[model samples]
Target: MSLLVDTANRDTLHTLLLKLTADTKPLWGKMTPQQMIEHLIENVQYTNGTLIPICRRSPEEALEAKQRGLNPDVQIPKNLFLGDLPAEYAYLNLPASVTRLMADLELFDRYFKTNAMAIHGGFGPMDYNEWIIWHSKHFTHHFRQFGLIEGDI
Candidate 1:
């Protein structure tokens, strides 16, 4: 089986995303499947240098957050909103949005390949491996929101 828990694994992401459809409704949030995919794409923007990240947490806070954020087993609480809210989905349609997400994922991988680290608004600076762990946890969170995965990742 694919390493389904590894968000950095392209095949794993692709396999999971194949379960998503426009009609999918989040079990705990207002986001539709398209919105969720777009949100993830926007997240990639921060690491790929498409969007500049503004660090919102103090250094100590960021340190603590990074500890938690990088733990793949840690589950982000349901219905919790981060301080930085993502903009509305572009609604480019499901297929279009998936295409963009795949492209953005490529950029995300490429960026990390060349750069050692990137700044996260809440968790501060993270190396490529740290970022991969963050993405794994994050995608697991969103997948649970849409009921795409069950139990622990």
Candidate 2:
């Protein structure tokens, strides 16, 4: 099944996350495990409208991003640079970051049904359902980075 942040998928996502450790290395890209966790947390905050994106997309760009998101065959773009890690997350340890990620996931699950809108840095504006799909795709993309989800990307 696709990884939605609802009851059926939450435990599965958490289980995948639990398999990660401080020494986990990426099959591609350069982010450390802790940094990845922080990145995900920050992105979740963005989905929930608690954080603003670095840039906003024009109407044409937003429509294009939405179409890309809806296309199941499309892989997330590779090596997309998202700037420096936030200072607050710079010194976080692996376990703490994992804990924070899990907590943030729960918070996201709770907030997702509120029908709020958020500006995705690359995807522009997304409502609740669009954000759910985007988050699922985003999480799956990163999980594959660490080889947590095999035979998929």
Clashes of each: 0, 0
lDDT string for model 1 (1-153, tens) is 122358677887887888998888888877778878888888888988788898899999999989987765566888886554446558568888888888887888888878888899889998888877777778878888898888743
lDDT (Cα, tens digit) per residue for candidate 2, span 1-153:
355333227778778888888899999888878888888888887665566675467879878978887566787766777676555554358778777777766776676667576677766777767776777777878888888886455
Query: What are the TM-scores, per candidate, against the unseen true structure?
Result: 0.88, 0.82
Question: Model 2 compared with the native: what TM-score?
Answer: 0.82
Highest lDDT against the true fold, candidate: 1
lDDT for model 2: 0.73
Number of the predicted model whose TM-score against the real structure is largest: 1
Residue 9, candidate 1: Cα error in Å is 1.2
Q: Which residue pairs in model 1 clash with each other?
A: none
